[model samples]
Target: MSHSFDPIDNQSNNEHFQEVLDKAFSNPSRRSILRGGLGLASMFALPMLPGCGGTSTASDAAVGAITELKFTTVAKSLADRIWVPAGYTVKILHATGDTLKTGVAAYSNAGTDDAESWANRVGDQHDGTEIFYIGSNGKSKGSYSYAAGDKAVLAVNNESSAEAHFFHPTGQTSGAAVGKKFDQFGQWTLGVRPAAEAIKEILMHGVTLVEVNLDASGKPTGYNATSALNRRITPETPMTVTGPAAELANLKAMMVTKFDPTGNTTRGTLNNCGTGITPWGTLITCEENWATYFTMPAGATVPTDTKLIASRTRYGVQTTATSATAATSRTQGWHTVTDADPTSRFARWNVSASGATAAADFRNEPQTFGYNVEIDPANVNSMPAKRTSMGRFAHEAAVCSIPVVGKPLAFYMGCDSRNEYIYKFVSTKTWDAADIGGGIAAGDKYLNEGKLYAAKFNDTGQGEWLELSINNALIKAAAFGFTSQAEVLVHTRIAADAAGATKMDRPEWGAVNHANGEVYFALTNNNASNRTPGKTDAANPRAYKDNDGIGRDGNPHGHIIRFKETNSMAEATTFAWDIFLFGAEEDAPAVNTNISGLTAANSFSSPDGLWFSKSTGICWIQTDDGAFTDETNCMLVAAVPGTVGDGGAFTVSNTMTVAGAPQTANQNTFVGKVLGESRLRRFLVGPKGAEVTGITETPDGKAIFVGIQHPAEEATAYNDVSKGVWPTNANNGVGGTYGLGGRARSATIIITKDDGGRIGL
Candidate 1:
């Protein structure tokens, strides 16, 4: 169970946008659109100007639209199996409980796989993966290197686990018999679970590294977990902290445990979502939605310090609850320990003021999390580090642009929350080809020292990247004054707010079009309560009800927004912007619902994971949805995306209720690109109840990997497998009775052309 949704930080972007909208729109038509707040349809009324930050005539050539989609679109399906184009073949490479070492017994395909084996096995909820080519001669390029090889090392993130019941026969009884407890969501309720169960689940929440080999025919045949390169970074793995905040006095004051009195080291990484590879041969694994996993101990008083209180409040940490026996809000009941020392590892889950000072308790435990963790995939023994300079709030993905010869590298990131701001980090060090194999050392050079920036999009087709540096005048005068640079990075959302960053609609994954130096992000839906008419802005413009019957509104179908930095430079503060794609049902009217002209082959909702393939220049869009689930399972779509100003401009009439007041429908114009099935086609629909995410391909685009997450998540109990069983029956048809027999588990599958040709060609 992830943390409950919190909108505290979202208000900053809205407040800032309101100020900008007040100054930009002067005409009556513009005022009507600005009155309720600009919907996406009204923001992109002009195509992005090339070379500089100004409007230009919209055109397919201006946006750099790709030629066409190559393969036939796979039809949408609610099947209990994977669906792909006719010639594409998919094979299960690894799934939950698969061995990572030679001596481990084969997974029994039953829930009986011992809790102890989970650490040495592939984990649950696989997401954000990468494949590192290992040549037949055992030689390879740097960590960021991509190539074709008969052998490769694959890394997959196990985001989280299902209920304890899924691991046993008697459900909670099996757990309680071993002194386990569960939360309302049926996940382990207490912070302290049965030792065996706790260890298993904790170990499952990190990354799985394994080596895979292809047969003579070039098809992936088998994988070996016993390979020397195979390794797992569990929640218990020790890691060093780096960046501005690592050595802060306040941070040190917050640490008292044996793990790190200096506050420069911490254990484990959680909620690892989208990932990135660096030019220096390393993996950038993001820690997202981590704040919800912590809780305040019962009876703990909220801190008295204004800054501490404000920071905690904004990050969604419980500070006002007075309950003495239960947590105010916690993702996992990791705080409900049984018999353990108050200062023990389990005690760290409850971040309460229980001791004389910050260092005497676990009040600062969460501060160590929510960062982009860097790992050297080539060096299995290398320790991961929390790159704190990347600015921590709820990180989605860290997509870096192509490194220029002498220019500083830039990384684009999104904070995965309602109306959070998009961010960028520019390395202080310029790029050098010699550092290709530098690994963590290179990370130390480029990642440790950089400028973090937040974006502010003006309604008049322009945007600026505001520096979050303490030297900036606006941040310096913030109500929650920052005492150090580390403070600004740690409480990044607040700093971004003070810097006047634009709030987005649940910003999730981001991708950089390395070809044209353009960036795209998935603004995955917001509800009416948070995105009321008055709350919409240029970047997050839509606020209308959908036919999903979920009763949710405010860009429920979401859209993909793209922009180009001036001079095609990553460090440039100004950029041109436009709406690249709007998610909608095919048959929906051409109002706000089907603005992108999506046809039957490509209509989708709640766009989440996004990746731009360097090999083929195709932007792959994956869905994690509920609004359109009644018609189709989550899917993966391949798109030959156009650049910034492809579609020119458009408008729609929409009725919305402002911050508590009802407003009549009004017409608004927005600049956006139009894509049909020819350019954007659904390539795959996942098993029922599974979200399509984590996509990557070989250098030649011959072997592609996609993550299947949370299969059969709707099943009520351990024995209720009738709801949906995937992978095991992925080749079988829909309905309660399908293929092989087993429970559902998140796994990564390999997709290849049956003809052994390049995929998406």
Candidate 2:
């Protein structure tokens, strides 16, 4: 709900402040006197006078007048460094294993940190983050950057991890079977060891909250370790379901208590990727790739919940051990850790059915995850609630609008898998200002009482929103056997399939344009398996392969799609749509590679992060990919986007030009491309082996923050130095052979102009 903070609403007051300051500085005589006094007085003394050398009043005016802005220039280019503009500075405000509570030592970075310390430190793989300014009264200002009497609380998602060696002192290989031996460790095989390791690994994943402060320069300066807002939520934390599942008494009992309830609220939030800030001022972290953390033991009896099994498969959870790969087998084996007992935390991670009844087996564990987890970052004592009304799937990101007083609120989301559809949840209840700081109570009103719909992009450049209601004929008749609305929401993919909702190419993130009320999503590359020969549709046209070992029938690289509400109402069912840009090589065919005049510098693959600046109209694009790393790592681009259908119609066909051979029409045709610098331009590049994802900005437009994930992911053995030492080189400017120094880590960076210029202008 929207709460009014009249004093901070500076539109009227800032003008008055500017008027007086302008009058004092505009006088020519005052300027001369200030310059003269500068030579005699200290730097700080100049600002004490009416027209002295404080940040020029003109600077404040420029920031205030910034109604339109565009991202310009590469901020910083770290060879192994995250890029920002020259005027901006970056600090490691909080790091993985950095204690959030007192009595915990600093992170050793040498794989010696204890689990208790990690439980109190920031979690690993920080992804999506939102800055919530805490007002003096302990309420959230909901502002992006710092304000007077405001203490900032950052709610960040810890996407995923590969720092196995650092998390465990002995390393995963310590007791591992030697040289591919499977049965050397008694009755257990090498594969079985991974299952045990998986349990421990799952405990390490989740969301983290830390309190950060701004320096005199208005940049993130330091983190307060003992801030009441600080917390770490891992898989071990106890969490409860709030919807239909909550009605199941046994399930409710398990949900209400944390794994160690007497000790902590919930274990942690796992596979947390993209997130949303509720109208109530709480954080909604989506659990993605969660199914991958579990395993079904071999020869285990299957549960009767076929619908559940199908749901698991749709989210990429394997039902059979035969489907396991080396990576999948080496998983933390949470199922086998405490296989002797069915009720132990270790056994809960195991999704296999060892007994006939649900109460006696772990088959229900998989269902516990894959739902959205809501956290009250400002209240450490609050237990995270999983709002089932939002529906469940491989949730990539959840984004919401600033709740309008007495108006219905909406949340937009995307299921991050090839061929998945975009979704939205419109609250049934209207917003009330009193609910602003209501936290979970507010969440129960808006998030827990909404209708879910999936997007369908048609061939005519128009899209429709398909509802996933239980009463829908398709859902009722579907093989998944949906018995109720709650069941339909939990098994949303099956319901969507029955409803015939169109599938997309890995819709990673959905961003709502605050300026125009349009929605944009990143379709991060779909493979041939998802596209039939004659089934390629207009919105997802151009299925081809490049010599770069990607996109063989859509193997790699992706594009972004944009659409506007039919009537500017979020509840509208119909809207126009178009491809905003295509990810491709600069030298590739004009039809396939070029979209809106994107060049090599700006061209990138797998667009993952999409955010529109409230202060500036410019759109920021961040990438996550393995396709373009040979040239450079992930990058961020700035775009001046025109609404859907802004570009003229064109066709695209794919063909090889070996020996200058001619191609057929089926191979290529016309498509649209808006040619110009204003359309799209590469703004920044990230450190080696890193993905440029997650972006947010200060409300005043003075600062922008971007996340750099998985730097040096290519390194295999942490002990071996020569593999890949990325962030160390990028951040410290120190380069040497592998493992020479500098260990790679995920981090977030802030960028701004030195002259106090508005960002993205």
Candidate 3:
């Protein structure tokens, strides 16, 4: 979905990465630059991203490199269809409204499905996906089995209701007739948000589990509609809230609602963006942008305790103070519906205080979201748990470090908003092989007890993880008032702010190299308001107007960053870092913008998803972009990434117009080895207006399941062809959109080589 949210990135006290580069890299021996891939430097580079194409030259065997990408570069495309290299083929396996039960009518592609029907249908806007099989190989069970009897399930996150335009017949009910389009009336719920319409939209924003069938060759065939384990986790599912927050005072007191008086459980999960496959055979679906679901109605008289006002203001759910934006910014207006029975399920969304006490009303509802939720796929009846110890924010992905026996495990995560902090949760319990299939019990043992730390990238290449715990004096004495470990976990952003964590450009998905322990994250661009001339620092070095014709100035083309833990320890508090790749259009300036030396073949912008194939060890980077859309839709690139500090530290001279004059400034930062076209090239491109995200390959590397989120997401009307017509061949198959005349849907596609060889090799 195109990002639509009022960001709570208003932080002033925290120290942004400052400039102190001269002494940071004083030691000359450690500086190194990769000299393998570059050719003669070109002063004038091309401006288009689709002009270059050829085979990749990346090494077939580096120190842990399992396989190299062997496919030809797929050119930039604007068509409404999936494009891959010459040998691969694409097949749609599952999509929104697809039936997951034994008996159901085919989705009309219209907004006519009954409200109760959504409970058994696949959700919309597919994001992160993980394939889990039942059998055991070693590391956490599941993945890769040619046996005919193996059970496999795919957990796909439905991130948002961005594509809700198609789910309804006449579009959302806005105030005016023009409100038929989602943009015109998306948040005008007070006008008329029918209970039925509101319920359907709410049900489509969580996660979906479907049983995938693999062929005899160990490649995925398709999803089975009637599998027993298939289900939709919507806003109504019962979820147990675990971790210290569930037991402590100030935080525990906030979890009460008429729906769950015990204060130990909550109802459902929403805005599940990215996912983490646990070492104990479970799935951790992260909640992102969940704050927009509730309305803090400007001056509505509600609970007067006022203890949560500070935390609410910091999180953008302002109660005592609300502007015109906050008044009507309720994403779906589910709160406007008048459901009278059973604690008024729809009323939970309107969080203004009204009843006698905190438990009487739903004022504390928003506090329940924004955490990493654990779900055990191996057990169909296991209840989901909100792992509050992981800390709450707009969680993107939770990528776990490679497990070592008797060593504490680390799960690296990024908050998906501009100026947000990245975090790592280290489990107190060491890895024990006995918990491989221990299910939710293993989650209780590890996830419920952990130490959460926020990242602090120093001016030097070295960085440290600032612990967000009561034991930390800084966290304990912060403005949010950390009374206990629970308050620190509940108001984690406030705690990280007090700990002086470094702010990063919208950090999206994170992935750990299976072969090596180095971790990678996608800094998916920043804007003019948050980044300025002198504010730019080493870790986030670029801040300039885009000279490209697209006119996205403020670091619109984002970059990928990687870091290695000290002494390769998962529990290390310090690490070294570098930029693995800088996303840019091929035609951008070569000196600073195109510093990674990308050609037309491998150029991409706004890397939002990062994953390493367990079978091939190939780092897969996916894009969710708006900067370079005129030339191409979002895409996925397969890479063989180099280690940290593979490139030397150098001064980055950026020219930005401050006030009315143009000025240039320099900052020192590190870049990893440049892969050129051969090592890093475009692997796949999605249909029009869609984000290419969430990818996972089979254990044998035969098939890769890629998610195309909300194809034609900007369509105003159901029949609007100018936006796109895809996954349907109604327009006689034109260059891009076939003009299929059908509603667009989010889906997962299976890509495999025609010759039955390993994908990307």
Candidate 4:
């Protein structure tokens, strides 16, 4: 989730008559209206601008009133097809395992690719992505090569891999499980007996970068096989911590004495989900759902610190057997791979209470994987660093603003779990336009230090940004026993609870309106089981099950909440907020599953992917859902939204019982509901059992790119060829074969309007 404040001075623009005239005549529909306002003789005689033609002064004046262009549904094909307006076209720019080096073979459509090849090829499961234009000299930010008519280097995040089975020649589970015991050094002397499987797990957990060239028409022409930018960052890659953890006297000493390092550090980034691109052009990949990868051994003693436990649980690390048995344990089973050395980087995947004390064992594994991983994709030699200043949580995505010449840039993010919170970080350093091409140095200047704040939505149509600082009195008085500011920031949820922040539905991708500086967040979904008995509020009113089979209690299918900073500034603590869009079935009752007539085509469940086109000002929404998958796979929609409070108020009911008696007329009301064809439209759909995620656009607005993740994800029986033939056709056609013969692999698709006209016009 990124924070974006509008840079446009709408009020000032409205006062300028000439600028208004330019907008109105840009579209044919508005032009027709302007013509009807004048008689044929006057219409033919009016003065016209270089880009506009008109007849009368009155007709020319009519062109200045258009504020937003109506959104139209572009593509509607059942098969996987790229859709756009008449002037656009789409092409598959690259897919998982596409090689970025000369000696590496091109991606074969068949299933013959191996791990060594894949390590050098594009990584699997491409999720959040950002395009950084390399300039003519191929050295700075603004001079993107694409702008100079050369290959554009994109820093894409291969969030996770589903190629474990394919990575090992005999499969990941081919080794036999054995039991072993270790002596004094807190090491496992004996246990499982698999060597090969252990190596594969270490290689599977990081991000990959690939470089490709786009033709003059904006389609990807080919990849630069030998591009220095091509690199793979895996679990074994050494990374050092640079914040509070690195400065701690005890931690620093331990790092050198025990781990043979000068700073608090760990190896590799795991479970990277959504990402952000810095104004300086670096990739900020977020780690989500990282706790489940590790397992603490049986009959082990856990630490007594609640803060540590909360940190582990917040990220979903198994605290006990209950947490382990409750979910599908680690898929790779790294612990079972080696008996004598279970803590070998492979065995460390398990975050269980083993050995004895923290000093003797790797109990700190839970603390290693939750920060925002910053990598300079252009400089592959640089070690990826974890920016702990950005508080850790189930980070969904990070979006940033276009750094102004001298403004405090802000990053907006969402924690993607039930009842999580929304957060923002305002860089302490002011922006300098000259820093645009400053590379990682600029990132260090703007992103390294910032104040983080969590949102608290109140009933009065307003929200407060509670500071997540060590100096806060409430943080000092914590009953949870957090000792320092760093600990509070690391375990931010507990601090948020103390600050009385409002509990929200699962918050996902967020986008900033380039046109208006408003921030929008998608509250994906939350079940009734999460709501407290008497805690219903206006923003999250439904606490009982509704007709949608979800939201029975808390928010399900979720809604988008938008807020504007006071005076359209990012540094303000006070803001006005309202629900922007609600996910619902078209036929459901107005009270339960309706947001101003949102229908199936445009209505989607669990908003997971969200982005605003820098060029078109269109908001793209994508979903990762189980609640609404019965009708279709996840989808993408294009939206034009008004600021909060644009629409009038409406009342929603909240039923509850007090003293074991039913209380009637518990009505909660809120404003902000304006929906119609002009505001929202279905832009695209995904293949059967896939999620349409990670959307981005070229600077020129000529092309839009999106990721198709896990096509046919539900097909679990790998050996049953007929049940999982998706991606591949019925004729056993493999690799590179489009149209039914090849297995469906996760791919990145580029879309453009066929006419080469300005998009969203």
Candidate 5:
């Protein structure tokens, strides 16, 4: 089953060394800095773009094929308000700390908010989101309305939060204080944050399911928290650890906590980032960069067990003794609390194997996380299940296409790390219309028995899916031996290495074109050390200096990559691919940075979040940029993408050297069709220090829901709070120029056409 193309062999020694260094330095708090890096159920049917082919039964006339974007692309802005097309208007449907239940007091927008009420309010750091419609019976009825009529439930992911001010009586304290700062990526300076505050921080890291109904004017309003379906799933929420690895003996060796001695359960999902909605009515929230949350105790021994060492090493799990130069450290220093007495509930943060059995100590606690967790939004009481079959890594998005009549369902995912590979999981079961309303039962059938595949793109503008199964000879080789399918899923990157999967720029959100079954991924920016010229490939073909924010060399402005399966089949092993768009300034050199021919109105960098409208063929691109922020804040852009092979193939230069000579030129790298302002436009620009992420919409295409994450993230001091004030319309210190508000908090905004018409038509 080996292919002639070998991606791993092409990696230079420097590239390999730097990758290891990158992994060694990665931590939870620096997630965006590290690399700048769903269920089914009673199910929301896969939305079909207006002119796309699918099962979506919207009433709007099909445009057949989206040729060009109709509305003028919104220009990039630094204003605090949500910007959109001229006819569109924005509303704050719900924000962080907003009371989900009517009886709870409104959020003070200050650090004085009650910690006990967090369970009844919308969580902080909103990242991923999806809107589900509910029927009178309290079950998911699904929605096709562009204007989302009446009953709807919004599932929001509160990715991560710093305990400092979130739970304190006054915003002054950051709860945990580290006396030593690394001043570098992987150095662990120990600080002390309160255990109670740490607990509250964990409580806010999961998903929030809130009930929503339109206001009198037909605009979305605050959540109905008291509704039976409103629920907050935090890290403390007990969830089943199901899948091939669920019962592995090695898995049990790390669970020292009393909560689940059997190692069959884990307390809460961590770093729940991009999310996906199942057709059968469930929410799949991805766990990204979950490793940094664990702390290596001060005197803990490094793992002697080769299997354990390999597992920890590959997943970037730092141990106590791991140094800045070495590959491990107490990234969060959360384990510092357990230093004196490592037996309390919070001691679970320590992953050292101090006990003989997994239940006796918390060594294996970290293994339970880093998987996609499924929750039934319709049933608040339903237990969430971690679907491990999809493979473990820093999961970004788990996007699924519309289920075809007899074809197996497929889910697309990206691991958000520099030089990481793209992945896909195909169900063993064929699509069954009878399972339309199957709920969790349907999820169990499809997600539990899928074949995980890593992608390998050829220099000839072609790619193939390499299966990551234990049965593969290379995977079972003496060097990379896998004991079971669970191991293959657990150590996916190693399996991908054996499979020769292509290394990409940091892969983030993935969107499947419903109109043609094409898949698009945002390869977020990379630094020069990793993306040096000699290491560039057909997929990651750019290496240039950014002229925008904090200008640096390398592919500072990332690009969008798209591929169409051979014969347009989701399960196809072969495919044709191309660069959909390269993120850059409108004036950047046309040769590399501006490969997509971006114009002023639609130019962007660090393309992070991406989602395609099921009602319109519009592909919404969102950014989380440190590279382009000097010019403007993070923004969202909309585009109507063409299928793969829409553009000509070309060669690019590689000035990087190996021993003493410059590397050869890159070959036959395929770029997407050059798009103009008519097809790509800046749809919205967020406030300062904010990332525009988590995008979803009503089936009718009339409404768009966008998640605003980490607004004013630069405001480190509790007192001054002047770095960036957002989401406040008054007293913003900008003389009311910023319309959103002053005190920054992540929130979700609902966008609708002021004319009551379909959005972006």
Candidate 6:
């Protein structure tokens, strides 16, 4: 992402913040969403595709019985290949356009596949991921298994067509206008997107499920593409809206379209990103950056409704009749495409008013997204449900508190933008271990009713949750209008704004500690305006130039924030907080930028994907970066974490000369003890032009599944291969003349240990 931006590109005064093809082959050729969550006002300024080496952070200290990462630390590399410790191995499980049905042919990777072929193929730009094991025998027949098993179903979120050009014969009319993002929608100038192309895009997003085989060996092999459970839940899939707001007139009225006049159901999920696994063996895939998909016809009039306008502005939803620069203002023209279908599937992308009634046009289409959609990966016949009770915004991920036998459950979430807020939903129904195999029905019983709240952190290492509901007096009489809870859920950003929630940096993925249930979130980098002067609060304090003297400003490297719930209880409204880690270049000034005493062995930037291994209590951190791509591609690192208050306070100074006048300000922030080599170390480095995200491990922690998204995004044309060559480079090294014509596909990879020992052990 970039350091500065015109207000028009982001207007972020406050708020926030792939590729493929398949043939998932090593193309001797091409490679490139820094996608959907392009908040109207806040998007990560991705650098245009496309390394380094390291030692192990010391593993001397132990947190309880949880030991440290034991593999020879992976060296930070720019080899254009996936690099792991010497004892580990990486396997390409599947890639974009890979066939899911046995009869389908392997992808040509030359962009020649017919539109219909995608229905039976893997979707592009994989994001969030989860696995559900199946019973080994009739004794556990027809039921999902939580324990280790041979047969398991995998659910992966195909976020966006980060490199849609690979889907066409020639290049599509698209360009990367912001940072280094894939920008599939940014450079498009098409007046009427072709129906065939449009349909491919429609089917490319949402989630993918397939059965896989796990072995007694340390590494799990590949998937069963022809398994009866293999399926794709794309935009055309039908789903019901559930939760507190589902029955309210506001949501129903706003959700009504010709396809579903009653507004009880909607079609498809988009921009699926982070994920959460319910204790009941189901997947909760979050919808991030779903707003930009529905744009008003270029040069249309803005909406006149005060509430509507406020909600659009707050959520960064493109509004009616707005003026945006060339290509930047338009999407691929999904609304302009014409088709024979009666439901106006092609025309539904338009959110502009054109008809007399709510059911007349696709004016309300945008309201239907921005919530977490639940899927039962093991049951292909079951319908997915959108959990509307989890107030919508640009949702990144949902990390649940460790389930207590009878205590209430809490799902922590982030808005994923500058100045946005972190939120959580407390279920009305407490945890019940009996619901372990309950699937979607279990989702209905627990997630359907909850009290939502936004987080507020004080400078003194303390924080509290502010309720967001009509029941709250502040929301009841707010100037935004006193409406039903449906309006509150739908316009959550506005509700949080009214509640005085703390503005964070771009909040991304969050993970809860298995040891003590402490919550940790990744505030993945920010620019100057978003973290403006005198706005450095304790939770997000640093603002400085990078160590390379590259002139990069703001908190470019990002940091991880952690907290302990009051009394270590999930239902606590107040908590203690501190910075668990401040990502840096390892050589920055220790007093400020490198406060955690980072070393080359464990330095990283833009901490976007984060998770804690439940089996071992070790923390896993992944990067999706634009700030540090020059020296290395994105990567995954492992660390042993300390408690929230273990860190000491440090004074950070930020100096910037305004119009030739030098000025400086300082802020004191608390942080955890430096991890050094023992507690923290690099684990895996991915291929060039790809993001390292979406990770999960098998029950015994012997194997890990990770998503390598949109590699070789540096290419400018459809057939450009010189910029990226991967998957092909995966097993060996870089191929001739750029993959020797191999295509770069966003793929799911499995990592295992050579000795059949637990991974990273």
Q: Best candidate per lDDT, number?
A: 3
Query: Which residue ranges in model 1 land beyond 4 Å of their true spot?
Result: 1-9, 13-66, 134-151, 162-164, 172-192, 215-219, 245-258, 301-306, 320-329, 339-343, 656-662, 733-741
Computed on alpha carbons, the lDDT of every model, listed in order, comes to: 0.70, 0.59, 0.74, 0.57, 0.67, 0.70
Report lDDT (Cα) of residue 386, candidate 2.
Answer: 77
The estimated TM-scores of all candidates read: 0.88, 0.82, 0.91, 0.80, 0.86, 0.88
Give the per-residue lDDT of model 1 (tens digit) for 552-665: 566678888888799878789998776677788887667657877888899998889998665555789999887787889989988876656545556655566565666544
Worst 10 residues of 2 by lDDT: 1-10
Query: Candidates 2 and 3: which is better by TM-score?
Result: 3
- For residues 40-98, could you state the per-residue lDDT of candidate 3 as single tens digits? 12201211110000011121122243334578999999987778898778888787888
For model 2, what is the alpha-carbon lDDT of residue 438? Answer: 74
Residue 319 alpha-carbon offset, candidate 6, angstroms = 1.3
RMSD of each candidate? 5.7, 13.7, 6.1, 11.0, 7.8, 10.3
* Sort by lDDT, top down from the best: 3, 6, 1, 5, 2, 4
Error of 5 at 564 (Å): 1.3
Give the alpha carbon lDDT tens digit for every residue of 1-761 in model 2.
00011011001111111122123233433221111100111211212110000111223222222222344556323256656534545545555556788888766666566644556777777688777777776766454323555777777787765555444444454244422211111112324444434443454568877887776655566678888788878876756466543334433433332233221123445688887776566788898766666666656566566766777666656576534333335245545553554337666655666665555655656656667888777677878887777887878888775445565676888877655668888888876767766767667666766678987655444668889988889778877787778677667777777776766667788886554455788887765444332233455555455656543444257788777777656567787776677777666666644534556546677788888665555678888876666666678887665545444445455443322443322332323445355446677787766777777766556677677776765555555435345544533422222221356666666666666665666
User: Where does candidate 6 stray beyond 4 Å?
Assistant: 1-64, 136-150, 174-185, 216-219, 245-249, 299-304, 322-328, 658-660, 667-671, 730-741
lDDT preference between candidates 3 and 5, better one? 3
Better of 1 and 4 by lDDT: 1
lDDT digits (tens) for residues 21-110 of candidate 5: 233223222111111000011112323342112245644234224556688667777655566677777777777777767678877765
